[model samples]
Target: MWIVSALFAAVIAIFAQLTIPLPLIPITGQTFAIGLAVTILGLRYGSLSVLLYILLGAIGIPVFSGMSGGLGIITGPTGGYIIGFLPAALVMGIYLEKTRFTSSHAIIANIIGMCITLLFGAIWLKYFANLSWPAAFTSGIAPFLIVGVLKAIAAALAGVVVRQRLLSAKLLTTKTVSH
Candidate 1:
């Protein structure tokens, strides 16, 4: 069951990467998936699923943003953002599991995940792009904030919806069996 969930999330991530490409950094729904994935899969498998997606892209599977691939792609200006996904996914997964994925809890977890992604992205961009803190904030974060916030909201809603759906299904199944 866990494996199926992981595979489902991974497939969604790959499709999201291919379909959604931002200007320099692709605006992926994968981050949203990362939140929901972790909420559903928990920490260990959630992180592993993200790692699997990255590995597939790194090995020339064209799963990166805008169909970008290879090791060099990861080391580029956007590399930090790509690398950020690992910890972001892990943090979000663990946080969501701990909170039990209520709407409020999902909101908090989603924001934390986005912040972690931005933090790692900013620091890495500072080194790779050679930008100052202000510059990095201006370029690396400022542009993405609006869209990132939307993504976080969407992720949180998705998390709550999926959780409710699963719980309802489980309850229905239980009642049917009891009858």
Candidate 2:
């Protein structure tokens, strides 16, 4: 599980580089990778992956969007979104774990995760960037709404298929039992 979680963290770093730069915050594949990790790894391992990713970034690893990293980025304007990934993954993974890990449920969970990320980001932008609430919403959430939904859907479909294949191959367990 740790190895898989580490691999997923690396996956997130790679995806983070696929950025379409925006003014305040850039659009990146981070969220898609996040959704994929949660859908496939479930609550414990998925959240671990997110935590590893954040810790790597916090320790000066260039794992964030645009090849940026370090504690500064973790405390920067876009930091909220990055930080929010943990809770988002937790919620998403929990949702899947509690219900069915179907494409439909994954889609719903991913969409909910997206909103959580945006909410954290907008609030952080408002304070860190010294922008008004409306300004934060405009720069942080507005531009990403449509694209975020699309990414969520794609992540859900892809994640479900990949997870099934992994399980069939005995590469992943049905669930991680708590110690």
Candidate 3:
């Protein structure tokens, strides 16, 4: 489990580097990876994997967006989004774990998780970036709406297929005993 968690954490880091620089927060593949991790790993291990990734970045490893890491990044303007990853994973994991992991359920769960992430991120942006609510919304949430939904759907489907494949291969347990 720990090994898998570590691998997922590493995967998150890898995705984090796939960034397109923006004014405030760069767009990256991190969220898709987060959704994937939670859907596949479920609550306990999924959350733990994100926590592990955060810890690694917080400890000064270059595991965050743009290959940057350290306590500074966690406290930086985009830090809230980074911090938001934890709850996002937890929410998605819990929902996926409880439901049948159908396409609809998975998409809905990931969408909810994405909203949580945006809320945290936007709130943090308002404070850290010294922006008003409107500004925060424009900068933080607006840019990601369409892409977020699309990514949520993609992540959900990919996660479900991957989970099924892993289960069949005995690399993962059935949903009931997963994690």
Compute each candidate's TM-score over C-alphas: 0.83, 0.97, 0.95
Q: 2 or 3: which has the higher TM-score?
A: 2
TM-score computed on alpha carbons, candidate 3: 0.95
- Candidate 1's displacement at residue 65, Å, is 1.4
For residues 51-107, what per-residue lDDT tens digits would candidate 3 score against the true structure?
999999999999998789999998998899999999998888888778777778889
Q: Which stretches of candidate 1 lie over 4 Å from their true place?
A: 18-23, 170-179
Superposed model 2: Cα runs more than 4 Å off: 175-179
Query: Ten-residue segment with the worst summed lDDT in candidate 3?
Result: 170-179
- The true-versus-predicted C-alpha distance at residue 3 of model 2, in Å, is 0.2
Order of candidate numbers by TM-score, starting with the best = 2, 3, 1
lDDT of 1 at 47: 75
User: How many steric clashes between backbone atoms does each model show?
Assistant: 1, 0, 0
| Model 2 RMSD vs true structure | 1.7
Residue pairs clashing in model 2 are none
Error of 2 at 45 (Å): 0.5
lDDT for 137 (candidate 1): 85
Sorting all predicted structures by lDDT, with the top scorer first, yields 2, 3, 1
Query: lDDT tens string, model 2, 1-179?
Result: 89999999999999999999887799999999999999888889988999999999999999999898999998988999998899899999888988888999999999999999999999998999898999999999999999999999999999999988888888897756221
Using TM-score as the measure, which candidate wins?
Answer: 2
Error of 1 at 28 (Å): 2.5
